[model samples]
Target chain A: MAELELSGVSKVYGAFNALRDVSLQIADGEFAVFVGPSGCGKSTLLRLIAGLDPVSGGRIAIGGNDMTARQAGQRPVAMVFQNYALYPHMSVFENIAFPLQMERRTKDDIKREVSRAAEIVQLSTRLQDRPAKLSGGQRQRVAIARAIVRKPGIFLMDEPLSNLDAALRMEMRAELTQLHRRLGSTMVYVTHDQLEAMTMADRIVVLNGGRVEQVGAPMELYHNPANLFVAGFIGSPPMNFAAARVDAVEGHAARLTVEGLGSFAVSYDGKEVSAGDAVTIGIRPEAMLPGAGEAGHLSFRMTPETVERLGLHTIVHAPVGAKTFTALFNGDPRMARGSALDVSVPLAQLHLFDRNGAGRSIRDIQ
Target chain B: MTFRSGAADAPAFNQNLGAYLFLAPALLILFLSLLLPAAATIGMSFTDISFLRPTNFVGLDNYLRLLSDGRFQQAVFNTSYYTLGVTLPTMVLGLLAAVALNRRFPFRVAFRTIFYLPVLTSLIAAAVVWVYIYEPYSGPMNGLLVSLGLPPQPWLQSPNLAMTALIIMAVWRDFGTAMIIYLAGLQDIPEEIYEAARLDGAGKFAILRRITVPMLSSVTFYLMIILIVQSFQVFGAIYVMTGGGPLGSTETIVFQMYQTAFGYTEFGYAAAMSTVLFFVILLFSIVGTKIMRKGEA
Candidate 1:
């Protein structure tokens, strides 16, 4: 296994910058995920590392070797495409044996290695069948079988499970994680699904507008998102942001008053803040449980627009004046549409952002 | 045929009558142009239907004569040679051109249009142009050969070279068709397959062989059948440039049949030849279609 380092890596397509000066280091055997929204340059960065596309600037090193100029085949990397991309004409045995055959191994060696890979993928019985005869999951196994047979230092998976149904995607997600653990190979997975990133990644590199927003463990990113974009992009029923003004500053505390929400006492680090300074306040949907509360808490009065009862959880979409956001609570079937409710956000769980979208949490300030 | 309006959920008489009226025009044309001639040809093959003589039913006389007909055998041999010669080279050239032009580059459209121009040109016009190019002394082909320090040789005049020369010209004229069809086939292959192949350590030639060629198999079979059938009816170029040649080396089945029916008025023998050629083409088509379907399976 080898560490992969991309320093100041960038990609430009004519006037558009797909990725700009983005750098990341994936340690050996780390399950690193590049997660972002659509058009957020996650796939572009993976393609650059895979050598499928050229980087317009900067360097890529694999195991501390300069692999920036290496062709895809010359690099110690194997990729599993999003579509599986199994050779439709070849049988499963040959599909897994392709890279070995390319290296011109002996016939016995090829047969032995291919069977071993097939057995690992639980595809031993279907080795004689062509890819067209296999189901989607089995075909993906063949693609995986093909990749692992080469024993490459890194496995580049680009949304490999996205083509499957939801149940199958979950199953494959767990299987891929197990595979990574068993093989101990560095895998750089890319996806737009935040849930997948949270569940699978050892460390996630959140990308936005071709720039690195944050790189941290799943819990770290969830608990402390560095900026407004990460805070909104990382979690389901994302943290809410509302306009607030500093009403008073006394010693090490600041009392911020939101327009429709009530005032909250936030810990003030030694930063210059006077009255009427504009700031954006963030509170997660889970933090806003339906309750009655007092100080050290931020209050919100919302009118429910829609309610979704998902058996285990209930999501209430509400409007606080002009801002529309959703709140999650235990499945409360009695929650009705158009109902007015007051939910309190605990002050310690609240997040604050200045006008420039840079984040500030109470832990850093206190 | 019985038309009953009494079957379960059958259409009423008026709707059925209207449907027949809607389909009658096309059916009438199909019967007149296709069915009638095919039936008549089968019938006439069993009898002597020469206009110069009273018709007589001769069941197996022409068939028995065809068993020993030397010139007809020679025509069959020449046609088979020309078919093989034309079909293979045309597909190879067409596939090469299609692959070369598949990627984006400056003037790609212009190059594609240039390659496709010969397919749109009239057959007689193209043949005439080829004839001039194959001209012994004045042609650019021999002129270039001489300038390259090689002796100028007759292109379409030599008996041994005439059929080969015709085959080359036919490949040049018709590979454009193969190119167009192969281009459409090439677009259907997903880009990820090639990327996967490359990651599998397949170099340029291996990707072409292992991915591109296998992916385009059905298209290759289709073009092969088309070129085989078209070349089996090869008459225009032979008539224009070779006229069955100095030693009848370029004489094909259709060209020989044409000479027998029109030039010699041997209508009975020519009809027999036409019937044999029809079965030969039918056999090739059936075999090709079966193989293609098997490949699909």
Candidate 2:
């Protein structure tokens, strides 16, 4: 295994930049995931690490050796594409043995290594079956087995699970985690699905518009996003943002007046703000409590627009003033549309963003 | 509203019938143009019909005669040579041209249009042009040879060179269709497959042999069937350029059939020859399909 690093990487296609000044590092035996929305350059970053694409500018190193100018085959990395591009004409065994054959390995060694990879992927019984004859999951396994048989220092996966159905995707996720642990290779995985990144990655790198917005553990990103983009992108049902104005700025404590909820004092540490300066108050769906009336509670009346009962919990789509947002409840609320109730945004779970969308620390406020 | 309303469904059912009725004329025209003549040919092959008389009930007489006729035997040999000569080279040349054109280059569209110009031109016109180009003394081909200090020989007038001339013209005229088909097949291959192959340490030739050729079998099978069928039916070029001349060296089956029917007015025999040609084409198509299917399996 090798530690992979990218410094000041960028990719430009004609006049458009596909990836802008990006830098990241994956320690040996670490599973780092690049997660973002479509066209966010997550997959482009993965391709750069695999050497499938040349960087317009930057240096890439593997095991402390410069590999920026090397060809994909010359690099010590293997990749599993999203489509599982197994040769349709080759049998499962041949697909797994292709890299070894390309390297001019002996026939006996190719067979032994192919069989070992098949065993690891639990595809021993399908050695002779062609890719067309295999199931979707089996074809995916063949793709994985093809990558693993090479035993490269780094494993690169580009949204490999996005093609599978939900249950199969879950199964493959678990299998991939086990495979990573057993192989102990430095793996760089790319996916637009935040759930997959949260569940599998040792560190999650959130990207937006070809730039790395934040990099941290899953919960760290969830609870303490560095900016508005990461805060809105890293969670399910997304965070709710409401326009607010600074009502008062006293020492490190500031009194913010939300559009619908009147005024509430939020602890924030940043440059002193004018009374009419606009800011945004962020709160996750799970942090909003129903029917909590207290001073500085940030309470507002919401008319339940829709109720989605999801067995273990209920999701209430409610309209507060002019905007509609979702709030997750632990039990069935037995609530119907058009019902009115008061919801409170807990100050501890609340996040305050300046006009530039950068987070302001609450401790600095006091 | 009731779920089963009879009045509401009547117009919808009648519209369906009216649609089928409107399609009758075109369907009838197609059947009359193609299927009727095919059925007549099959029935006429069973009789012995001379040009000026009623066809007599001669069971398998034409078939028997064809077995011993030296000219018919020569025609079969000539047709086989022409088919194999044209099909294999055209396929290879077409594949090469397609691979070259698949890359980006200046004026690519213009080049593609120029290469495919022969396919769009009428075959009779192309053959007429080629006939002049193959003239023995002053043609460009002979002039080039004379300029190069090589002996200028009779091209279409020589039995040995007549068939070679026809094969070359056929390849030139027909390779565009095959090239277009191959281009489509090459485009259908996903870009990621090539990327994966490259990352697997495969060089260009290995990728072409192991990835491209295997992936292109289905297109190859299709092109081969069309080329073989067209090769056997090669009449316009042979008629316009060679006229089956130079001791009948270029007398293919279709050319012979045309001569028997029109030049000699031997209608029944000509129909019998047409029947034989049809069966030969069918045999090739069936055998080719079976081989391709077996390879796939």
Candidate 3:
């Protein structure tokens, strides 16, 4: 196992910049996931790390050795493609043994290693079957088995679970976490699914528009996002946003006039904001508690337009001045359509952002 | 339920009838052009019908004679040599050209079009051009050989070299077709497969030998059947360039059949040859298709 380090790595295609000055380090035995939207340069970064593509600028080092000019075949890395990329003509045994065969290992050694990988992925019984004959999950296991058989220092997965169904994706996510624990090898996975990153990654690197937005543990990012994009992207149903103006500033406390929600006193650790400064306020849907009138809490009135009862929680979607405000309540609540409900959130849970989409909240400052 | 079923049945019947109407023209053409000639050839093979004599039933007489005819046996051997020589080399050259041209390079489209021009040329025109190129005295082939300090040899005149020369020209004219088909097959393979191979530590030649060739097996099988069937009927080129000359060294089954029917007015014997050739080609096609299906499975 080895750590991966990329410094100022950039990729440019003609005039389009696919990745811009991306630099990060993953510790040995760490499961780091690069998460972003489509075309956010997550997959491009993975390809660069795999040495499948050359960087337009900067250097890459694996295990503290410079690997900038090495070919992909010469790198100490193995990759699992999004579609598995199993050789359709080969049996599972052959596919798993491909890397060993490329190294010209003896017949007995290849058989031993392939069987070990197959056993790890629970595919030993189906070793002789062609990839076309296997189900989607089984094919994914074959790909993982192939990567494992190589015993590379680093494993790169490019959205490997995206092709599986929802249930299978969940199962594979848990399996991958267990695999990471068992292997204890550095893995850099790229995905557009935030849930997958949140569940499986030891650290999640959030990317947007070819640049890194934030990198932190899952709960750390959830509790304190670095910017407006991370705040909205990290949580399900996302965080609600509302425009607000600072009415007054008094010693790390701001009195703000929130649109359609009246004024409130919120604490901050940053420099005093001048009066009449514009800022955005955010509150998560799940953070909204039922009923209002909690002293020192931020409260608002919303007319529910749609109510979704998903067994444990009732998600109430309502309109508050041209924006959709969602309030998730524990268990099922008696929420009716077009009825105004008083929803309150703890004042400490509020997120404040500058007009530039940069986080300027007390939690972020801490 | 009965009323809905009755209403749906009428439209379904009309839809099928319209489909059949659309298919009728092509089916009729196939029957007239292919099935009719095949049936007539089979019938004529059983009768000694020719311009030299009155018609008479001669069941299995022509077949019995073919088993013992030395000229027909020589023609069969020449045809097999030409087919094997042309097909194997054409496929190999075509696959190499396709793999080289599959990459993005300057003027790739221009190069592809240049390689494909031979396939679009008329067969007789191509044959005539090749004959000129193989012209012994002042042809480019001999001139290049002379420049390279090799003895100038007669390309189409020597009996041993005559079949080889025809096979060379046929490959040059037909590898373009194989290349075009291979280029299409190359497009169907996913790009990620190559990336995975590279990450798996496979070099360029290994990827080609282990991944590319195996992946294109179905396409190869298809091109093989086409080339075999077409080469088995190699008449036009040999007719234009060799005319079954050089001691009948370059004569193939179809060329001999033409000479038998039109040259000597032996229509009954030629019909027997045609029937035999048809069955051979059909057997090759059936076997090829079966192997291709197994490969797919």
Candidate 4:
């Protein structure tokens, strides 16, 4: 297995910049995911690392060797495309044996290796069937088997599970994580699904607008998103954002006033604050409690417009001033539409951002 | 219940009638142009109705004569050779041209149009142009040979070279059709297949042979049947350029059929020949279509 390193890598297509100065390192045996919204350069970065697309600037190294100028086949890397891309005319045996055949390996060796790889993916029973005869999940397994048959140092997958249905995606995700643990090979996967990233990645590299927004473990990114983009993108129902203004500053604590939510004092680290400075506050939907619990908590009144009782938790969506606020409560609460309720979030969970869209909370400051 | 069932049957009958109405024009054209002529030819094959004599039922007389006819056998051989000669080369040239023009380039569209121009040209017009090109004394064929320090040779005038020369012209005119069909088939193949092949370390030629050729077997079979059927009825080019030519060397089945019916007024014999050709082409078509469907499945 080999670690993958990209330094100052950039890709430009005519007037459009697909990836800009992207640099990251995936440790050997790490399941690093490149996660972002569509057209956010995550797939582009994966392709660059795979050597399928050439970089416009900087370098890519795999196993500490320069692979920036190498052809895709010449690199010590294998890719599983988004669509599986199995050769329709080939049987599963031939599909998995393709890379070995390309290397002109001995017939017996090819058979042995192909069978082993297929067995790992639990596809040994369907060896003689053509890809057309197989289901979508089986075809995906064939693509993976083909990639693994070559025994490449690094595996690159470009949104490989996006085509499968939800149930199959979850099963494949668990299988892939188990496969990673079994093989101990470096894998760089790209996806626009944050849930996939959160569940599967040893580290998730969040990208936006052709640039790296943040890079951390799943919970690390969830707990401490570096900017507004990561904060909005990393969580489901996303984190709620509200405009607030600093009413006054006292030493390391700032008193902020939010329209319709009254004023509260939040302790900070090193960020300089002055009177009447506009700021944004973020709190996740799940962090908001049902009632105004005790004093010193940021509390607000909201009229529920819609309520979704999802058995274990009841999610309420309501309007607070100009923005919609979402609150998730454990167990089903008697929440009704058009009814006003007070919700509170602990001060420690509030995420503060300045006017520039940069995180200015205590976690970010330290 | 009876009334409701009767009302439902009425709409179903009307729907059937509407569908038949939509199909009527095409069915009428097919019957008048194809089925009627085939049936008439088969009936006429059993008769000696030449219009110059009292019509009589000849029964198996025409068939028995055809069995012993030396000229007819020669025409059959020449037609087979011409079909084999044209179909293979045309398919190869067409596939190569299609693969080349499939890529993006500055003049790709212009090149594709130029390559496909021959398919749009009239057969009579193209045959006349080729006849001049093979005109021996002043033709460019001999002119080019003489320039290359070789002695000039007559192309269409020599019995040995006339059939070959006709086959060449027919290939030049027909490969464009093969190319267009192949281009359409190429479009049906996904681009990701090629990219996967490239990433698998397959070079250009390997991908064409292993992936492209196998994937397009159905298209190739279809083109072969079409070319063979068209080649079996190779009358217009032969009639215009060679007219069955020097020493009857290029006398194909359809060309001989034309001469037999018109020149000798042997309409019964010509009808028998047409019936044989029709059956042969039909067999080829049925086999081709069955294989294509199986491949798709």
Candidate 5:
């Protein structure tokens, strides 16, 4: 196991920057995931780390050695592709034995090692079956077994579960996490799913438009997002934002007027804003408590347009002035369309952002 | 080509009659074009049917004569040699070209088009061009050989070099077909497989040998059979360049059959030669298909 470091890593393709000045340090045995949207450059960053593609600028070092100029085969890494990419002609035994055979290991050693990996993935009985005969999950297990047999310093997975069905994706997610726990190997996984990153990563590097938005633990990013992008991306149903203007600034406290809503007193810790400054106020959907009129909480009256009762909880989608906000409640309120929702945004859970989309939680208002 | 439109009652007599009626036109074409000629050839092989003489049933005479015919034996040897020579090198070169063009390189499309140009050329047109290239004097091939300090020998005239020269020309003319087919096969392989293999520490040669060749076994087997079957019936090139010349050295089975039937008016003997060649090619194709099916499983 070894640490992986990227120093100012940049990838450019004919003036389009796929990744720009991305620098990160992943400690040995850490399960780091790069999560982002479709064009967010997460997969590109994984490719650069795997040595599948060269960086247009900067260096990559693994285990304290520079690997920027190394070819993919020269790197001490194993990759599991998105489609599982098992050699269709080879049986599970041969697929797992591939890397060891590439190293020209002896017959007995390859057999023993392949069997051990097959057992780890619970594919021992299907060792002689070709990839075409295996199910999607079993195929991924073969790919994982292939990577494990190599005993590489780092394991790279690029959207490896995206091809499986939803049920199998969940199953493989848990299996992959357990595999990482057992192996204790440095794994760099890339996926566009925020849920996968939230569940599997030791630390998640959220990317947006070829740049790092924020990198933190799952709950840390959920509770404290660094910017408007991270705040909007992390949580399910996402956080809602409403345009507001500052009316007064008084000793780390700002009185803001939310358009189409009402005025509120919010605490801040900056000289960055003054009267008449425009900002967006952010609140989580679950933070909106039903039946308002709580002191220090901003209250608003919205008309519910659609209500989704998901057995365990009720998701009330209501329109407040020009924007629609989602309010998640703990119990089904048997609410109907046009029902009155006295939604209250708790003062303790406010996320303040400047007009430039930068977070101004203003030094821990909570 | 299978349909179950009335398959619920397919076993009923009248229900099946409609299926047979619908299949009649295609079945007629198959009988006239394939089955009839094959049967006629088998029937004609037992006779001495020629324009100058009465048609007489000769039983096992022609078959017995073929076993001891030295000229026919030489033709068989030449055909086998040409088929093996052309098939192996053509496949190898075609695979290499397909692999090279599969990568992203400048002018890759232009190069691919250039390689496939010969496949679009007519067989006779390609043969005529090859004849010019293999011309004894002042030809491009001879000119280059002389420039490289190699001997400018008669390419299509010498008995020792005649068959080899024909096989080389055939390989050059037909490898474009192999390349195009191999390219289609190459496109079906996803790019992720290469990435996974590279990360598995497989070097360039190992990836090609272990992954690429194994993954393309079915395609290779398919191309092998096609090339073999096509090469076994080699006629046009020999007709244009060699004409079975320089002591019958380049005479293949089809060339001999053409000479027997058209050149000498011995239709019966030509039919026997064709029947023998057809069986040989069918055997090879069957064996090749079996290998391909087994590889897939």
Candidate 6:
């Protein structure tokens, strides 16, 4: 277990920048996940930490030792790749025992460690089988076991469950969480799936365009995002944004006029915005109700376009004015297409962003 | 519309007809070129068939004569020596060269073209070029040896060195085919397997031994079969370079077959030698296939 730190790490390929001035610190035995869309440099950051790739600038330290120029084998890190790159010729036992063999351990020590690692991954009976004989999930377990036998200071996983099916991915996600708990090893994982990041991470680092947007606990990001990107990216059905203009500014209260809805008052004392400034209002799907009779009723008429019935909950897509929005309901609603209905947007649950897409803190805004 | 109950049976008949039509040209070519000549050879092996006379039945006389002929025995020993000497080294060298060139490098295409150039050259032409280079007095090889303070010894003119010279030329001219096959085999290995090996803490040599060699067994078997069969029938280089000279040290089985059938007009003895050579090649091929299958299992 170690505390890994990256200080001003940057990777440049010719003239194109893959990562720029990215710095992060992961404490000892913490499970940190890097989440982003494709081409956002999440995988590059993980590779840099794993020493699989070189950093063009800045330093990387593991366990208080600077290891910026060390090779991947010299670094105290083990990586489990997305493809589960099991050696095709070796049996499962050989694959897991390879690291111990490299360290020149005795036969008894190698055998005991390999079996112990395999038992942790529930692969004791599969030690004699080759990789080709295993299923996708089993191959992934073998890959994880290969990493665990090394007893490295940090575990790096680069989208390790992306190749498995949905059910297997979920199962392995839980298994990995449990593994982290048992081993108490510092782990840095990278994935494009937000759900995986939210469910499995002690701290989630959201990246966009090769830059770190926010770093916080999963629910911290959900409840209080730092920017428009994190607000739109960290939820199941994404948050909705509508253009609005500030109507009136008073002490701690600002009236805003949404494009389709009527004018409403919002608390905004910390925000430096005048009365006619442009701002965007964000609302979660579950926060909006399908009724016009409410105290803070920012109501609008919309035609229900599509209704997705997902057993426990239903999502209704409705067209208001020229924009489309979705609302999540607890049960199935008997709403027909092309029928007009009023929807409410709660004032406290609305997120406000400036013109530059930076979130105005709800508490700071008041 | 009525659903036909026997559509499956109709497809089966159609499939057989289609398969026969697809195989017609290959089967016809095999019948004309391979099967007919094999059947004629089997018949001729039992007879004394001279070029200008009626074929006379010899029954086992050709086989009996082959057992007593000293030149034929020398031919068989020389052929086996050549096969063992060339096949193993050629397969090993070709595999090494293929693996070295498999990675991305500067001017890789040019290197491949240079390596494959010898295989495209005619065997007679290659032998003629090598004969000049192995000249005892003024050849480039002897000159370099002399400059290096070594004795300038005869290469093809010595009985002990003539077979070695021919083996060198044969390996140089034939290793390109093996290299190409090994290159294809190396490419078939998925990149993920190599990545996994690195993660397993395997160094370069261990990965080559534990992963590459085992994966390329099939290609090795294929290359050995072709090299062995070709070694048995090595005649063009012998004719162009040594003519089985220098006390007949380089006289392989095929060269003796050519001399007996065409040089001395002894058709029955040559046909007997050909049959024996065919069996030798067939035995090697079957053993190679069996070993490869066992390795895979």
State the lDDT of candidate 4 residue by residue for A159-251, as single tens digits.
999999999999999999999999999999999999999999999999998999999999999998887888999998899999999999898
Query: Would you list the rank order by DockQ, best first?
Result: 3, 1, 5, 2, 4, 6
For all candidates, the clash counts are 0, 1, 0, 0, 0, 0
TM-score of each model, in listed order: 0.95, 0.93, 0.98, 0.97, 0.92, 0.93
Which is the winner by TM-score between candidate 3 and candidate 5? Answer: 3
Model 5 chain B lDDT-worst window of ten: B1-10
Arrange candidates, best lDDT first: 3, 4, 5, 1, 2, 6
**Model 5, span A1-366: residue lDDT tens:** 889999999999998999999999999999999999999999999999989999999999999999999999788889999999898878899999998998899999999999999999999999999899999999999999999998989999999999999999999999999999999999999999999999999999999999999898998989888778888999988999888899999988899988657888988776788899898888899998888757888888888889999978889888776788898888877678887867787787898888855554443434
Candidate 3 lDDT over residue span A1-366, tens digit each: 999999999999899999999889899999999999999999988888888889999899999999999999898998999999999989999999999999999999999999899999999999999999999999999999999998989999999999999999999999999999999999999999999999999999999999999999999999898778999999887899998899999987899997688889998876636789888888999989989858868887888899999989999988877688888889988879987788999888888888744654433533
Sliding window of 10 residues with minimal summed lDDT for model 3 chain B: B1-10
lDDT per prediction?
0.88, 0.87, 0.91, 0.89, 0.89, 0.86
Question: Candidates' DockQ values?
Answer: 0.82, 0.74, 0.87, 0.68, 0.76, 0.51
Off by over 4 Å in 6: A269-272, A357-366, B1-11, B15-19, B64-69, B290-297
lDDT of 4 at A65: 98
lDDT of 6 at B199: 57
Which CAPRI level is candidate 6? medium
Tens-place lDDT per residue, model 1, A157-275, is: 99898899999999999999999999999999999999999999999999999999999999899988877888899899888888888898888778888767766678756375667
Candidate 5 Cα outliers beyond 4 Å, as residue runs: A357-365, B1-36, B57-61, B137-143
Query: Each candidate: RMSD to true structure?
Result: 2.9, 3.3, 2.1, 2.4, 3.2, 3.1
Model 1 CA lDDT for position A359: 54
Candidate with the larger lDDT of 1 and 2: 1
User: For chain B alone, what TM-score does every candidate structure achieve against the true structure?
Assistant: 0.93, 0.90, 0.95, 0.95, 0.93, 0.91
Give the top-scoring candidate (lDDT): 3
Candidate 1 chain B weakest ten by summed lDDT: B1-10
Higher-ranked by DockQ: 2 or 4: 2
